[model samples]
Target: MIDHRRPVGPRTLAARAKAAVTLSASLRAAVSAGEVRRVVCLAPDPHARFAAVELGADFFVDTVLANGYGLCSYVFGWNPARQTVNAPAVDQFLGGYGDLVLRPDLATLAPLEPGVWQVVCDVEWPDGRPVPEAPRTALRERLADAEQLGLVPSVGIEQEATFTGADGAPLVPAGLDYSVAGLTPLRALLGDVHAAVDGLGLGAESARGEVHPGQYEIVLRHRDAVAACDDAMLLQAAVRRAAAARGVRAGYLAAEASGMGSSCHVHLSLSDPEGVPLTAGATPGEPSALFGHFIAGILRAAPDLTGIWAPTWNSYVRLRTAPFSPRSLRWGRDDRTAAVRLAGSGRSLRLEARFAGADAHPHLVVAALVGAGIAGVRERLPLPDEARVVGELARTPWEALTLLDSKPARAVLGDPVIDHQLAMLGEELTAGLDTVTAWQRARGDLRA
Candidate 1:
C-alpha cells in the first residue's frame, strides 16, 4: 500500500534552496538539482548537527520533530582510517554507564563520502555509533566470503513492517483486513519506498498489504547482496517517512507494541561467473551438494544464530507458535512453524530462514547464515534430522542462542566475531530494558 500522495513532484532547485537558505547557502547550491526531500538535521545532539553542518546539510530540526515528521536522514561519519577517535577509552567509559555499553567515540564525524549515500536522517544509532553494523554491511561481508569460494551470492529482500495510528497506537486490535483504507498511512509510505528502491537499483518487486492489520510487505528482486540490503534499509526509512507524512509511524520494531510483529524474509541464491545458478545442481529438480551444505550449515548453527534473528528480548515473544510466527529450529518443506524451510528442492532449492524479525540486523543475520553454510562445507558437518515437530524445537530464543554460544559453536563461528556480536546484542538487550517510562511505580500495595 504505497501512499499515492508523495511530496507531489520532486522539489525544484529554488524550493530546495528555500528549505536550505535558512541554514547555509552552500548546501542550497550543492543540492540545487531537484533532489528528493528525504534528508533533515536535528539539534540537542549538537555533535550530530555540527557533523551535518560540515556535510553541507542545511535543513535542521530537533529529535522530537525528526521522530514525528520522520525527516531525520543521514549520519555524519568518520572513517577509521581518516579520523582519530575522540576518546581512546570510550568503550570502557560506556560499559560502566549502561548494562551493555556502546562504542560512541568510535564514531568519527568528518565529511560525507562519495559512495551512494541515503537520507538516513541522523546517521547515528541509538548508542551513537557512526557507522553502524547494519544488515547492509552483513550482506556485503557474506557476498565477499562467497566470492572467495568462487561463488557470487545475490538476494532479494521482502520485508514485513507494521504501522501506527494517527495517535501513535497499534491498529491491530481494531481488525486486520489487508485491503482496509485504515492502512492508507502505511500505503502512502510505499510510494516513497518504490521511489527509493528504483533509485537504488535493487529491483522493486511488489508492495502490498499483509494478513495483519497495518502490516505491509515490500518484495524486491534479487541483486548483489549489498545493493539489496541498501535498498531494503532505504525502503525501511522511506516507509517511516511516508507514514510520518500521513500522521502515522511505520513500525520496524519486530514487536512494535504488545503483539504486532514484523519480519525480514530473504530470497538468496549463488551463481557462477557465467551467471548460472551454481547451487542449482546437475538435475533441474534435484538439490545440489552446495545447497545441502548451505542448508545444513544454517541448521547446525541455528542456536548461535539466534542473536542475529531474535536480537531483542521482545523479539522472542514473536517466535513462539502463533499467528504467522515460528517456534522451532526445524526445517521442513514449506512449513512456516520451522525456523528454516526448504521451499523449492530443484535447481531453485533454497531455505527460507523464518527466524529473523524486522529488528534483527540484516548484515549480521545474512553473515551468520552464509558463514554457517561455509563452515558446514569446510568441516563436512553432518546435517541434523529434519525437524518433524515444533515441540522438539527450543521454546525460547535464549535456548538457541545459548546453544550457539557453546564451545563447539564458538569454535565454528570464530571466537572474535561471536564475541563481538554477542557483546553488541547484550548491549541492545540492556538498552531495551532501560525504557522505564513505559511502566508504573506503585510505592505501596493497593489493599482495597
Candidate 2:
C-alpha cells in the first residue's frame, strides 16, 4: 500500500484537475454501461518507469496528482543506478515533478485487459503548462520541430528481454539462438505475449530467440513517432504481464549476463509532410542529403546522448564489457557493429540506433534523436565517413554527465530537461560510488 502521509513538503500546492481533452463522451458512456471497468492514465517518468493513475468508471477524478493522491516518477530506491527486487523506498521525492493533470490523448487509448483501458496521457501542471520531465512530452516537442521542418519521423522498436525461474536461473538450459527449435520451449509463452500485445492493439512484426538462454526479442511494426513510442511502452507492459502469468520473471537489466544483455533498438526514418519518403536520394540506391545530415546529427549528439540512451550505471558496464553493442559513434551500411546502422533502401531506409538499453525511456531516446536531427538539418551538417567505429560512448554515467556540461547537450535536449536528468543521475552516481558492491565484497577483502 502507498503511504498516503508521505509529505510533499512545505506548502500544499492547491489545485484541481479538469479533463478537458476531447475524449468523446461515448467512451465515457461505455464505462457507465460496464463495458469498461477502469481507465488508466499512463505516462513515462524521468526514471524509466510507467507512472499510472487508475480511475473509476466515472472518468472524472479531480483528486489524482493532488489532495494526497499524487504519483512520483522518480522515487524508486535501489541506488538509482541499480535495478532491484524489493528494496526500501528512496524517499527522494522532489516537488519539481509537481502536481499533474492527466490530459489523456484519446487516439493512443487501447484496451489493456478485459475491462481496463490504457490511455497515453499528457501530464501537465495545475496552471496548464506541460511538464518538461514527462518523456512523452519530450518526444512530442521533437515531432513538433520535425513538423516545422516539413518532415515527420517513422519509428519502429525492437526489444529483447530474458526470463528467469524462481531459482534465479534462465528457464532455458542453453542458448538456442534464432533457430525455430530453440524457440520451441518458449512458443506457448511467446504466443500468450503475442495475443496480449495484439489484444492491446500494439502489433508485433516478428519475434525470435536471442543469443542468451531464455531470451527473446520482439520487433514492433513501425508507426508515426508518438504512436510508435506508445506501442513500445505497451509492448513492455504486455510482456511483463505474460511473464507473470506463466510463473516466470522478466529481466531487462543492462548486463543481465555480460554480452547477452537486453537492448532496445530504435529504427528511425523520415518522410516529408506530403508523405514522400525523404531518406533516400532521387536515385534508387543512394541516401539523400537530408539522410546524411540526420546521421551526422545523431553522431554529433551521441556522446551527450549516452545518458539518455544508457541511463544507468549498469548500462555503462554493459557498454564497456558487452560485445556487439557499439562503443563508438560510427555509421555504416548494414554493418551491425556500427552505432548507427543505415539499413534498407527506398521506403524501407532508416537509421537503427543500437545504443539504448532496455532500461532507457523510449520517448526521450526518440526526442533526443529528433532534436539532433533537426539541429543537423538546420546547420546543414555533413555526414561523416562510413565506418564501423569512430568517437567512443561515455564509459560511465558520470563521464556522460560531464560530457553534457556543454551547449550541444542543451541543444539536443532542452536546457531544463537536460539539467533535470543530470541532477537526478548525478545524485545516483555519487551515492552508488560511495557504497561498496557485492563483487568487491569478495574480490577485494576475501583475498586481502
> What TM-score against the true fold does each predicted structure earn?
0.66, 0.86
lDDT of 2 by residue, 294-346 (tens): 88888888887788888877787679877668878898889888888889988
**What digit string (tens of lDDT, one per residue) describes model 1 on residues 169-235?**
7654444444666556544456665554454443456777776666777776655554445446656
Looking at model 1, report the run of 10 residues with the lowest lDDT sum.
Answer: 101-110
Best by TM-score: 2
* Number of backbone collisions per candidate: 20, 0
Model 1 local distance difference test score: 0.51
Instruction: Please list the C-alpha lDDT of all candidates, in the order they appear.
Output: 0.51, 0.72
